[model samples]
Target chain A: DAMVIQNPRYQVTQFGKPVTLSCSQTLNHNVMYWYQQKSSQAPKLLFHYYDKDFNNEADTPDNFQSRRPNTSFCFLDIRSPGLGDAAMYLCATSRFGGEEQYFGPGTRLTVT
Target chain B: SQQGEEDPQALSIQEGENATMNCSYKTSINNLQWYRQNSGRGLVHLILIRSNEREKHSGRLRVTLDTSKKSSSLLITASRAADTASYFCATESDFGNEKLTFGTGTRLTIIP
Candidate 1:
């Protein structure tokens, strides 16, 4: 049962405060991705780490950053939380260039 | 901008009935995939259909792709109450390492 795991299924943060969401995978997949999904909207690609190389989406705001310090662990950091930033943050992993992806239980962030 | 759009934002049907969801994408895709998400949880990979493959099936799930329309459909037969969830379609472009672009999801409720 290799699985992707996300910590703190629910998070509450105050506006202008910093928050961090963590994802770890036991599948040991080569590629890890972060997506932000707002209510009834598409899950927007934030960025991904292929091994250790971090690739950010062109439209991703500068306020958002990701760190993949190791193969199985990744973190998404919001430097300054905003109300609009509240959404379900999903973590997904797959073998490089593979068509199938496995997703972790998402972290739902609530910015107050 | 959302690269994919899923039809029938929400659907409610009786258990044992067939459920179908459709997705249309804007660009050339290397592959199209379907995923399921339970309430407030992560997405579970359902199926993947390559750009060249016209149809694929797994268990009670059937996926069809039409490159001309840049569209794909997922059909689930003999669906149960457990099938009530959000289903989303994601596309991988012909670009590097197959980064996925996901669509707005379809919320399916199976009435028991």
Candidate 2:
């Protein structure tokens, strides 16, 4: 089955340490997205990649960055993890302009 | 700010009973989508209703869209314990962008 996959479902990082979360898809979607979700809250858009172009949300912190090395893989890098940054990071994908998005299982980040 | 807001932040119902949740958005949307998320998990797309469409059904799920009111509703009939999860409404703005703004969500608990 074609689906999105995320590595290291659970991650722990120390304050000010850098951490990276990875997402890969078999769906061959042209758009991939990264979302941050805190407990009991909506998933907030961090950024996304349409093909090779990166689009970051205006309110996204400067400490967050993303890279799409190829069609199937996208990575989210946290330059300096903070306690407030601990949350579930989700990765999703969809075909160009498609309304339905397929999401990965998500990576839970614990920043100490 | 969040574009969509779901009402009845939490709901509890017995198995076999139907569950309904409503969502309101602040902008013109190309389409509205509903997603389900189990506790501490990624989201699963349930249904999508386009601006031109009023209602749609899939399996036991029924979704209604009211463009004039800028609102939508999701009805799940014969709910089961497995259906216990958080339901969210996401809107795709008519601006031709694929980014989705999600609602806070309604936490539904189905009593067995």
Q: In candidate 2, which residue pairs get closer than 3 Å at backbone N, Cα or C atoms, i.e. clash? A: none
Native A-B interface contacts kept, per candidate: 0.83, 0.78
For model 1 the local lDDT of residue B106 reads 95
* TM-score for candidate 1: 0.96
TM-score of each: 0.96, 0.99
Candidate 2 lDDT, B1-112, residue by residue in tens = 7999998999999999999999999989999999999998899999999999999999999999999999999999999999999999999999977799999999999999
Report lDDT (CA) for all predictions.
Answer: 0.91, 0.96
* Candidate 2 ranges with C-alpha deviation above 4 Å: none
For candidate 1, write residues B32-112 as lDDT tens digits.
999998888888999999899999999999999999999999999999999999999999888745588889889999999
Interface RMSD of 1: 1.6
Among all windows of ten consecutive residues in candidate 2 chain B, which has the lowest summed lDDT?
B91-100
Mind giving the per-residue lDDT tens digits that candidate 2 earns over A23-58?
Answer: 999999999999999999999999999999999899
DockQ of candidate 2 relative to the true structure:
0.81
Measured over all alpha carbons after superposition, the RMSD of each candidate to the real structure, in angstroms, is: 1.2, 0.7
Off by over 4 Å in 1: none
Q: For model 2 chain A, where is the 10-residue window of minimal lDDT?
A: A94-103
